[model samples]
Target: MSSIEIHQFMCRKDNFGVLVHDREHGTTLSIDAPEEAPILSALQEKGWGLDYILTTHHHGDHVEANEALKARFGAEIIGPGREQDRIPGLDRPVVGDEHLILGEVLVETIDTPGHTIGEISYHMPLAQAVFTADALFSLGCGRLFEGTPQMLWDSLKRLRELPDETMLYCGHEYTATNARCALTIDPDNLLLRERATEVEHLRAAGKPTLPVRLGQEKKTNPFLRADDPDIAKAMGMEGADPVEVFAAMRKRRDSF
Candidate 1:
């Protein structure tokens, strides 16, 4: 199998655009088009040409540049099967649990429909990475905009099941705010407190806090802690259903 290289950069305010390159095949794909300028710039900077655009969901910010990039590079576009109509320039549509061969790399699509009913995350086991779009974020999860809290919670569970070492590349740079909100709910958690401090320091230094290890998120992300007895107890929802606890946390985060 060919080794894969990943590049992550800021695009359109807080959104993050990721590029995945299969070195052996000399093929490069963008995780989401995000915005044309930055995506184009990144490709130029790397001396790579875009061959494909993989869309995770139907949100405007995520797919807004799909057509432009495809036009500019003549790249084939692959996106969620359920929302193919919503994504621009979709050449191949995929649903959950599908395997796609991009160069020598195997891209496994996991259907995580919560942020949007057709949200998908791309997992590359060989690369030890997952591009979680808006379904999961660093220290946080996407808001319940189109799906129920239970659906979103279940989606997060799928991601949490990945190997602890899997590096998470999420959609946005919202870790600082997520850290603040998480601290309010898990103040007694030593790791959570420490992670919050570290996140602040990284942001202050103008560095990206993303591509975090799933192991670290499991230890500190509040959304992923709904099932923890301590967190449930701290929220006064002890012995309640984890989904209920998750719902409560989501509500609090909404207002937070």
Candidate 2:
């Protein structure tokens, strides 16, 4: 079986760094550099050299190490076309539905404009994985930075249409915190309760609780389960549309 190797690094406070290695093609892709030192350190630890830099958006937390990494690695920078000017070190601007090969894996871009106006999530159908930066978290989604509830809602719906078995790698280590908020929106949900317990234990042990499956997210994550009846009632907004419930939940989390 052919599969890409994924290395998730803790780059900055509450931030992430991912390195995808395609052994068959001898190329490596780093997703969203948060800081220079940690990413370089992680690469050195893995003994991997970067070939490409994939930027999901223009957020500083996501792209602060772009310039330095590109300078050091001499790698091409791929960015969302909507905000190429904002995304530093963007060498290649691509739009939604574009297909490109990095090593042996083929990556397809899916525009998910909610956390940022130009946010784009990567879908690797061949590998059955995705690099969802800040758009969809484990138990929640990102704060609506430059888009609307409708925009974010639609963006997640699009991601949901991917293969149910898709492996999700979000941009931050916010699952435990997000899962806490998820309980407020899905108090009696058995899946949420179980997921919370698992996440809590892992975090208590100082372990990572990420790379949640899409199928699991559909069942337990309140942000992804906005249409579920239990989630609606728990949010104190039964009989409401999914978007309405999601918006209210987001508002509550923003204050929490």
Clashes of each: 0, 0
- Angstrom error of the Cα, residue 158, model 2: value is 0.9
- Considering summed lDDT, which 10 consecutive residues are worst modelled in model 1? 1-10
lDDT of 1 by residue, 204-224 (tens): 999999899999999999899
TM-score of the candidate numbered 1? Answer: 0.97
Report how far residue 132 has shifted in candidate 1, in Å.
0.5
| Candidate 1 ranges with C-alpha deviation above 4 Å | none
How do the residues 212-233 of candidate 2 rate in per-residue lDDT, one tens digit apiece? 8898888887787777777788
On TM-score, the candidate that comes out on top is: 1
Give the lDDT of residue 107 in candidate 1. 90
